[model samples]
Target: MLLGSPTVTREAAVWRRRLGGNPFTVAPYALSCRAAFRAHRGSFDARWRRLQQLAPLLSSTAAEEGGSLRFVPEAPTCCQAHVYLRGDAAALDAARDAVLRERGVRVYSRLRGAAVGPEADECYFELTLGPRHLEVADAVYVGAWRAFFAALAGPQPGGRKGVGDAEPQS
Candidate 1:
């Protein structure tokens, strides 16, 4: 579920109303991936670096509809960046699962089409972060994350990281 200030909630509600559906519930809504870090552990510098490092990886997984990463006001110490993707459920799910398995990043699927009517899916997932010393909290899905990252680091035929080289971590 989305957790934030009234402004953020209002923004989302506005976007949802304008779009006719909650982006989080619509099948073809934007895929927003947020990497939120703990407040007490890392400096802003460190969190910024981690956010930068993760952006490319997140974008690399976007579907044909396109994607982007940006910083927005969230909790005081949380380094929150969102990835927006527009595509089908399969494609969106693939991207979401990849991020989940790869970094255990906290992700929220939001956006609602104003004219899509009542069929929009309300199903979604959320992660609870714990205290950690790292810039970003450890992914809750450890096994998938390890496998995904390991595959990302896997060797390529010409020593180049192959596109889509890493399969979804089962």
Candidate 2:
């Protein structure tokens, strides 16, 4: 199913028509099958292990600040975790911006449109434990995530209401 907004989907369709077809159908020929398999296997294993180790810590950190972690039924096999904060889209965007500007860490705030499913318009951040993250210390990542949530839970400056003032959106 298409996951983007109508405009994005339309643009993609136009581009696809202009390009003759979808470009992702072709597989890269840079690696042999055996080499590709080995590389993917190693990366997958590392990511899985990192996910297992970080999920709980990140969840607990969120919990400490009025946030919670939402995992799908296939969370065990998934490489990403979703953290729901007590706020609206604007609050989430503000927190994300603050975290990036202050901590120099990038955090994603997902806003799924109606096309995705019933969970559309939900305010949450997606965190993934990938191969690149495998090398970083767990404490470092968790600290940044914690700070992000804290920013959401705290009061905003300049007389702006913070995320803590808003009701949690499902």
What are the per-residue Cα lDDT tens digits for candidate 1 across 1-170? 67899999989888878878754576443332233324334465555555554444443443111332222221223444433333344534554556665456535444322223223432222222233424343343333333333333344456433225554588
Candidate 1, which ten residues in sequence have the lowest lDDT sum? 68-77
Model 1 lDDT vs. the true structure?
0.42
Which ten contiguous residues of candidate 2 have the minimum total lDDT? 112-121
lDDT of all predictions? 0.42, 0.64
In angstroms, give how far residue 16 of model 1 lies from its true place: 22
Clashes of each: 14, 0
Task: Evaluate residue 50 in candidate 1 and report its C-alpha lDDT on the 0 to 100 scale.
Answer: 55
**CA error at residue 156 for candidate 2, angstroms:** 9.1
